[model samples]
Target chain A: MENEFLPRRVRIEETKMMTSLEKWFKLDAQLDFKPGQFLEISVAGAGEAPISICSWNGVEICVRKVGRVSSALHQREKGDFIGIRGPYGNGFPMKEIEGEKLILVAGGLGMAPLRSVLQYVLKNRKKYGEVTFFYGIKCLEMMLFRDELLKLMEEENVNLHIAYEIEDEEIRNLKKRFPERFHKGMVTTLFEKVKVNTESFVVVCGPPIMYKFVLKKMEELGFYKERIYMTLERRMKCGTGKCRHCVVGIGSSSKLICRDGPVFSAIDAELIRELV
Target chain B: MKFLKLKKDQIEDFFDSIHSFGIVYAPVKSDGKISFRRAQNFSDVSLEYTRSQIPPKHVILPMEEPILKFREEEYFEVVDDENKVLLGVHHCDIIAFKMLDEVYLQPPKDIYYHERIKRTLIIGLSCIPDNYCFCKATNSFYTSDGFDIFLHDCGDFYFVRVATPRGLKVTENSKNLFEKVDEKDMELFVKAEKERFERVKGKNLWMIGDLIELRDENFWKIFSERCLNCGNCTLVCPTCQCFEVYDELEEDLKSGNRFRRWDSCMLRAHGLVADGHNFRERTEERLRNRLSCKLGEMRCVGCGRCTVYCPTGIDILEIVRALKE
Candidate 1:
């Protein structure tokens, strides 16, 4: 009962300045949570917000200053205290899709959650076949986790594709750092570059507008919708299903995105609202 | 079946007898609006009312509640509600509580809500449908369970059925107040039940096939029109249980409480992502979401609070009825 609303105080081990708007926080307390799961972090003045786990070795979450909670988190330095709860929501079913190819996509901050799978796949490299990650962000300033991304590019049997909407000096540095892996357009352009076969499995996370275009492109390229996966986000208050703020109706029956899913197969994405 | 008879003259004594159960809240009319208030005296309780403007669900999940208290980055307490007994709850609203139980009392159940439920007793009343009432249409007017006691109004007396053991004990303690019902009393009770059920038999607005086919985008805009997104509909609804959580700090910034307040999808920001993207951008989309959530294939208990409380007089049932066109 106490665990329902009580959050443990976790100290920030270290903080890396990703960009002006984003920062990476490494927690001293490592929680027993799977890849693709997220934690609700609450500060004093700002309320709780869900941040996706990007690291498998430690408790690391990437925070983007898009709202009040994250903005308040951005101001804090290393060793500051923050309230934490969860490892909530079903993560990517790694064991189910084993021995198959993977197509991982990340748009802007979407990279944070997908990075969890990226690290997990790299560790168990033989369990998966051709693994590809398509990461795209606006311009170059919003691009996150650059040092680790460059390390991922060098790994054998793993391919990292990067795209920038607009060019900047930071993007040029990234192009030089990863060499031939960088592209000049949106992430949709990366699909044209991919040799998407029947065996390839897909995991996608992005802004709400990105799903329609990305899914359409995947279908056009002979990618099966059943094998594709997505993580849907809503204004979730209670990570559990008690608060109905995160509910999305699929036909007549309703499902809470927090409890029923944050990770859903592409076919199951019907539970979320789509823009026409 | 555990029926007990309380004469019309003994209703006042019946209210006085319930104190040992918990603090009692019954429907009362104040400022030209009906609401649940603590029964200081039974004379203030309205027995002839159609429905209270707000459902008694607030007793379980309040509009605002302090869930956690923290001081200097350390949590010290989790607040829980005291014992309560809700009086004059309608059968439809009783059904709504069951739906709420399905949501909050499931696995990894809400501790705060379960704590509240453990301490509360429900007393249900049977209602004859009014102009704005549509519980019969939703098939929720008749409740078999989910209440401690159910009071069915019969002429010259109230037929009270003690549904739970706790209710039986309470009734037994007040044995002097109730008389054994005769054959004539049973006949009158059956007649009232038949008449109430027959009046709203053919006027159902909820059909699964009609709801599925009402997907025209042009039709959706009509829903948000002649309207304000004041969220009064969801606020007044017994089944609408969405909420938003916030953290408040003292001026010194050392201590504060984390609380949750009722929220509605009708608000433009209800679907806002943490990264600051509002998914339900248009008012039409917001309205579509609530309607789909309310009646799309899901069971509507048809409390009719939304229709009664809409300042713009947006009849949600009329829109569903229009779906046939």
Candidate 2:
């Protein structure tokens, strides 16, 4: 039997500074993974952290300088080899909602996972219907994949809605380019601008606080509970269910976020009272 | 499965016979606490102890161990394979082993735990309840499996029940020391089990599942207020398997060992995530989570380790009874 704890070595092909805190890494490994699945990125002496795979074809992860593992990751550049135990967790239900309209909701660093989903949709463009992407970030500085989002704006049939908390020069310049798409408000505010079809499958990935407000907005907009899928985050050790740190719910209903899900529907995530 | 007998005088020889399997660790009393310790001699093993303060989970999963050793780009898996014999493990603890197996030996198996558990042999000992024990109420009083051999204490003799091939081998190898069970010996063995059942007095926690649904904040706050969050209960718990991984560097910063250490959910850092977000910030919230787990999926074996080990006098049995009320 293979040791699940053993991490495979992957060298960094390239690295980019996305924000003051977040750094993007392009690995020399092509992992077989779905949209929302994550990798347990280990930095030897610095330890491990669950980083979401941002690229579909190759292994690309965005690391936010939040804790030890990520901080150590930021220090390392291209040519550095790190150990990775991953592509774990139930990723986005891409096949399930293949033919349906997709409402992609992402906040801050949550875009990393959604980018994988969007990339898959963009690849198999003929297999999907209308695609709507709603991205929310603090400002231009914190925004990840800004160039890609801009490129996505020009794509036929795909609508990009960008929400910024602060309205600065860059935001004004972006708004001047696409007045209808760019808006000055929170992620929930973007919902008011769009005509949300109840039939559309909504995939929301964001901070813990974003869920309550976003779910409420989606509910008010008449989105079905079954169709609204969201990826969650927790302090994970073993991506396997052995470590009870990332567990959600209580008793028999308890689920290991690492094993059972990082992606759970709004209805299923309801078991976690603090979550949805 | 077959029943045999070993007289009290032949225990030393019996212990000696089992030595070929591996090192035998049995209960021993030290500093007014009972815990499993390696027996160099038969006399070192304590046969009269009701329960060990700590469960024998370390036999499978150690408190701390190195998983990997890294030097620059090269990483090597740290392997520790030691054949072990755990003697005098109570039925409650044996059941706890089964629970650990469910998590570790399932699909995406934890290789470390799987390797350790496979090499280790279990020799269960029947135990009667003390004031701290409620294994009977939790339906873990009797365990017919999860062990190679089980010994029922029958005063002058031990009524041995062999459940595995290796267990039968031990009996076969030490056939001279064993004797055929007579009617009186069987009677005494049955009586011992009856005594265990009668002495096991506590609330039936199996039906207390609804207690987790109790939204009374004050009820949980009462316990949380007294809780030091020292995480002593999790350390002593047979089934609490939460852990955190870190790295210990050698003098040369290029090389280090990635170690996994036992972590407790009671600590504030357990739930604290990056960006200073604590999902379970309040004491009552963490208390509810721990109790809900004990009441829910990770059912307490009712060994009463938490009740006895808690610095403050917080009795889980009393809490269960109160929840029932």
Candidate 3:
């Protein structure tokens, strides 16, 4: 039996500084992972954190220095080896909504998983319909993949709208960089600026506090509950579903976010009231 | 069921026979408390225990279990093996293993736990619940399976039933010490195993299928009022599988082992996630989640460990019993 908890030490092939808090680590390991699936990266004595696979080939983990494990990861330089186990959890349902218009939404650090989903869709651009990506972060100083976001604007049939909650010198600098793409309010403000079809498939990933307001705004704008997909966050230990820490139940339905989902429909999403 | 009979006096021979298989552990009286310990002497193995102070689950999921022993790329899975024969396990514990097995042995299986299960054999004892035991009310009163063998203390003689091939092989060593149980002895053994169940049924009439129904602020006030948050209940639990894993560097500094230690939801740090979001920040919320999660009917296996070891005597069963009102 393969020990799921044992992490394989993989050398960091490349490292990129996206922002002060977030750094992207490209690992020298070929993992067959779905775009939005996650890998539990261990930093020896510091411990492990569940990081979403952010790149196309699935080795890159765009992580924020939010906790101990990630902070330890940020301290490590290129060519350093970190323990990794997974490419675990169900990713975004690409096949289910194939050829349908895709509205990708994210808030703050939530952009990590949505970036993987959007990049995969862009790989075979003709297979999907119009793709509108909406994102929001605290300020411009927290921006990640600025070069990549700018390059994505050149892609045909793709629309991008980004918002900053706090206005400062960083916001003015970002406005000078991409005047048309930047907005001045929360992610909810993007809906009025860019119109997506009411029946189009929507994917939303964000911090816990953003779910209620974002989902409510999407609902008021006529987006159906079943059409909205989301990735949930919980205190996950053993990602194999052994630990009950990540168990979230709604009504008669319950799912181990590690196993059954990190991805859930808005109907079942309502059941996990703790996220609200 | 294959039944064999042995006198209470002849039980020493059974313990003696157990040594050849492996180390045998049973209930022992030390420091005025009964805990499961190595049965070094047959005279010390006590079956008079209503329930053990510490569950035999530690034999599988220890307080600190190593997952990996590593030095960068060259790492090996750290696994501990011991051919253990655990004695004096009650019906509640047998039921508890079923729930723990569901968590560890199911797909996306835990190999560390699987390796331990392979090396261990359970020898069960029939339980007589005192006023404190509420296993029967949760519909986990008895288990016909899980252990390799089950022993019923039938007055003058001991009735033994072999439930597995491993058990039958162990019992074959001392075939001469046993006699076939008659129909009369079988009836008495079955009746005693089931009779105490009725007394516990009406105590907890709380509906748990939907958790929102059981929520009352007064119940929270009362349950958390005495809860010292010592986590003695989770430590003694046979079904609580929540663990926190971290690495400990050895003296060499180059290599170390990653340890998965038992963690409890009752702790303040248990619910704190990345980005500093605390799901259960309030004292009552943490207290409520533990009861609510178990009420969904998965984690708790009806072993009243928390109640038995609670310092302030906060009976979760009685608190749940009041929830019915």
Candidate 4:
């Protein structure tokens, strides 16, 4: 009999600017959640927006200043209190991918959710096979969790590949310093440089347009449709299924994205064409 | 279930007595539109109507409702506890009400909706279909549940089928207001039901095979061009439950109310995400999504309100018939 719309207050313990548009916040609450699950962040007068949980241990979320609620979040200081409800949606299938090779593909802001899975995978490194990380951004400035991605480059059994669209003097210098790890093009460009395992479980997250190209490249590289998992983003008003705004698929196959998924298999995404 | 008969002349007394239980909301003709309104007396109620422009759903899920009130760091829930009696609801709308219950009353139930629905009583009235009605095609012309009491017109009396304890309470309190149904009364009830069943020969637009499979571009193009996206169809739909939640602040900006307003998927803003990406950018895509969602879940009760209320005359049954062809 709990009210599903009610949000509990959580004070911000810390805040960091990841980019001009994306800001990171660490709350003073500990939430037990899976990787791809998102939080419905509430700013009283501004409204609510869904933010992806970017950290593994505590309540941390990445907010991009795109609309009203997120812009309000950007104006708040470290100690300001905000309302939060749910670590909703079916997150990544962490248990299913155990002992399988993980190829994490993140585009721009998509790194937030993938970061949660990456940290979980690295902590239990011996359980999994190899970890391949491919991150693509518009430029070096837009790269989220830059220091973390750099540190991940040195982790054992993990191969990190990065691609940036713009190649300025700074990007050129960085590319020269790390020739084998950096490439200049779309994230799909990194696929050709690496020796992909046909059996690897590929997890992708990114903008709407990026999915089509990335999935096509994965198909070309001989990855099974069922093995490729991607978390999708949709306009969700309520985290629960009652609000039909986040519905995907058609007819009997129709499923609420907020309840059934934020992460879905490539096969489901194929069947529900709206997901990609 | 119990069968009782109330004389046609006794309806006014029954209506007045039910006020003791709760506020009575029934069909009323006002400003050239027949809609549900609070009945102060039986004279204000209209029994002869095809359908209300806006459904009685607003009795439970209002067009605009406040779920929470926030002041600084504290938040409180705004729950309505008033008891209500929604009477004269058609069979199709009763089925539509059950569909709304299935969504809101499922796991992780909506407390606001639960509170309103629990406090309200529903009374179903048998209605003969007009040209706009296709409830028979949707299998919603006849309903055995989702109503406390059902009244079937039988000439001088109404054959009352009491399906719930709340319904029985009204008859019990009224004493001699309702009489026991005899064999002749049963025959009249059967004849009345038959007349209603035969009257619903509107359109046999029963949904064909998977509508998602019928995603023919040319077929959608002809209809999408005519769609104004005014969202009148969704507003009048009994089963369209999509909503948008937002907060409105006072002038001081210290306090605000979090409100959920009825929203339509036909609007562009419904599917637009944060990063300026709209999943349903074009009118064709929105139209397809709406039709497919309706067919997929069997959400369309075929009340034909959407067709009647639409400014562009985009008949849904016509589209369904074309798909069948």
Candidate 5:
């Protein structure tokens, strides 16, 4: 057979620098993908990087410019094409968590992948129960999808809670746009103010450091580890399972962030020591 | 099977004939030690050496390979290589190749690795074991499988056993250089090889099982301190398959090529993420990961290539023995 593992070139439809740490690129391809599965974007001459799909339906990648491949992604334009392979890894168990009260949390660029789930849940609104989006950023300027999110909150039956670590005045102007939803302080504080049943499913995505504190708050708020889900970021080289660059957990039993999961339940990720 | 009485003088002519078919690579003396390299002459190939400074892994899995090249938004293509024959590979190195094959050639096989592997022929040489050698621990001191042809040193002549149709073709074509197999000569050769292996093992070498037990022990701390985090071990290791892919841009900024290169877990950045969190931050953890992958994870295949090419002479077998305490 021919080289089946090779990536196909897909033109970039749109490109936006999400924050100082990340960039979002929407590819001109119909990639049938789940919320948590990721794609390996190849920058010709640079290398391939496994970036999580942030868009629900179309192929879009939210990449943090951390390493060589990511930095190259930021340099490309809307018309430029890059090699695209895979919608790999186990996505969030959307089918299983349907109809349960959902608490979605996004921290900084972590919102990129979690946004996929948010969009999915929003599209199929009546299929699930109450949906609460608790998005956290270092400041208002770092917030991604600010305009889209404002529009999302305006829709009926959606409870959106946006927070920043900086002073309240920084986000005061945004109050006019999202008067009822905007809140101050850390994202975890929303757990105290919000009320939900024990059957609620909480999804969290952020830096590795954010996990411990967020998980602690979830536990205090009567959310078990199994009820909470999170995504992990690692140095992935080959999106295919060959390179073994992204294997985590103890004993180095490979959990390919590219193939196994970018999103895992809090308890399911407990064995993974380095993931936040 | 054949016990051919070709003098050492005719070895160059054999290599010359093999070179006509394809490029032949073998261990050649470099600096003070031997390393696998393209062979220009038979005199440079060292079959008597214990082990080379580098495994023959690079012949298949190159240190730097271009997965694909792209020029702006116009064109993109991948580069494929030609066929070659690798000669004088040790049993340990061959076993390492097998381990690599199991991983890369598994379900959803890697096209890049498969392309190079398909065009290559493996010729294994049975060498007398040395103090540093511990292939027997992994049950790969001598391999009758995984090779197209197996060669054993029988005094003045070389005993060749063809294991594949390709190997049989090469032998049949060189009929003038080989003699028919004699039962008496085969028995004597096997007996001599067994005695040689036993003599090598009698020297107080480390046991493989002891190393497996020490994987969780405190012995890692001592070894970790000595490691400069240079990644030399992973670079020299034949079975270390970890890699990183990145894009390199030209001055125009509109075009670039994506390439994947060898990466090592021993490096500080191997486990680091974009947000500045390093999974294996401690030297002890990185060192332990490398050892465990070599001993426990890769133990079933029995490829001792890692032990053979360690620059610091960090015998993993010895480390495991120390851990057993």
Candidate 6:
């Protein structure tokens, strides 16, 4: 047999330093990817790493320089080519929540993938019920996509709430720029203040630890397991199912994250011991 | 149809004749244990050996084969190799390879695996019952359908049975190496083989049905403590086919090759993520996955190769028994 898989080289058009550790890259092509699906990004000699596509419409990835591949990506400039394999893994199941209210919760870099779904909802606003966005970060400096988010929040029929963990001077000064958008507390605390309907479809993405706490709050707030969804991250070697690197515990069987899901309903994921 | 009656001394001549056909590999003694290697003489082949330290899968699916090569600006191309023969394969190993063939050559065929597989011929030797073997439990101790040629060792001679066209061709070419078999010789060979397997069954290793049912039982905590997490069981297992892929590049960063290597679920990092989350972090969880893959998955064809190669001699059968309790 012969290997049939292919790798495509895509050019990065623009780069924005989202935070101290994270940078956003806008590529030249409109990569047909769903929200919460990730791309296996390769930097020739360094290594290949999987990065979730944080922005839709345009292909962009918010990469944190944590490992060799991510660090190499941070050092690269615009017009450089990066090998991309896929927009793999199951993304947010928007079809199941089409007619329900939407609640989006993102913590720190979690906003990256969720930003895609949030953008989709905004572009097709009339298709869904009330939309509420709750985003939290470490400090004012760590907040990403500030200008674009500000413009999005200003748009009619959108309700956006932001929070930070820090009580620093820079945050105090920046609080004046958007008085209504800023709040100081943990992201889960904001859940109590927001009004959510019983039929609301909640989408959550964040560090695994943060999701545990936030998901508990959502459950307490009367959200059924079926109405909640989460995007989980795992080490993926081949975005295709051949490598078998990204199998996650789902119910009684191990589900390949590349094929079965990166996005799973809370009910489907509840039996997974590690996720809980 | 004929029965080969070559004295033990003439085994060397038999191997020399087969070598003219193509590359023939057999288990040879290395570091006091038998390992499958290129055979130059019959003295190097061990027909009475228990099992090879490594599975025969490597002869078909190499550990680190470059599936494809690509240039940055040009289209990618795959690599394929052909024409090889593996000799003296144990019954369990043959069954294990058959399982691999089903997986890799199934729908959405793995081209790389198929290229090597199609080029190779399998020559199997019926195994004498060993202390560690539990192949009977997995119903793979002896396979009548998998091998191209099956050889039964009878005191001073080899009873060769050709099963495939390739096996028949090999026999036809070595037409001078056999004599017509009589009913007396066949009866004696069958009686000896049955007695050999019956001795193995008397060891109580074959009664593992109750243990198999308790594979998912929560008694793994007790059994997991002994697991060194060394990953010896998975590496030696013929049917364990999990893998990890990565890319290597030239220093100039202008070109690179994506490659995949064998990976085991027994390791901690196998289940780790880029975002600092690991699902099977604990040793127990890793152990559970390993057991589930072997027993619960029902994928293991009961090769008994894992038990033979395990350094600690961790009897998976014993673990199953503990689970039953």
- The candidate scoring highest on lDDT is 4
- What's the interface RMS deviation of candidate 1? 2.2
| Interface root-mean-square deviation, each candidate | 2.2, 1.2, 2.1, 1.2, 3.4, 4.1
Q: Ten-residue segment with the worst summed lDDT in candidate 5 chain A?
A: A249-258
**Clashing residue pairs for model 2:** A251-B296, A251-B297
Model 4 interface Cα RMSD in Å: 1.2
Total clashing pairs for each candidate:
0, 2, 0, 1, 17, 3
lDDT of 1 by residue, B274-295 (tens): 7667767678777777777777
- lDDT by residue (B132-196, candidate 5, tens digit) is 66566666677777777777777766677778777777766676876766786678678768876
Candidate 2, residue A130: lDDT: 91
Give each prediction's root-mean-square deviation over alpha carbons: 2.0, 1.3, 2.1, 1.3, 3.6, 4.0
Q: What lDDT tens digits, residue by residue, belong to model 3 across residues B1-325? A: 6888778888888888878887787888888777888888988877877777778888778888888888854468978777888888888887888788888899878888887887788888876667677675566777788989888877777778889999888888778777888998888776765575654444453456464334666658777877777778788887788898887887876688888889988887787788778776766766777776665554566767788788999877776656665
Output the better candidate (3/5) by DockQ: 3
Worst 10 residues of 1 chain B by lDDT: B205-214
Question: Once model 2 is optimally superposed onto the true structure by TM-score, how far is the C-alpha of residue B118 displaced, in angstroms?
Answer: 1.2
Pairwise lDDT winner, candidates 1 and 3: 1
Q: Write the per-residue lDDT of candidate 2 for residues A174-205, one digit (tens) a residue.
A: 78888688888989999998776778999999
Return the clash pairs for model 3, or none. Answer: none
Superposed Cα deviation of residue B147, candidate 5 (Å) = 1.0
> How does residue B205 of candidate 6 score in lDDT?
32
- Candidate 3's residue-wise lDDT over A194-248, tens digit each? 7779888999889988888888998899998888998878778778887767766
lDDT of 4 by residue, A97-180 (tens): 998998999998999999888878877788888899999999989989988777767666689999989878988887777768
Model 3, residue A152: C-alpha shift (Å): 1.8
Model 5: which docking level applies? acceptable
Q: What is model 6's DockQ versus the real complex?
A: 0.30
For each candidate, the DockQ is: 0.61, 0.76, 0.58, 0.79, 0.42, 0.30
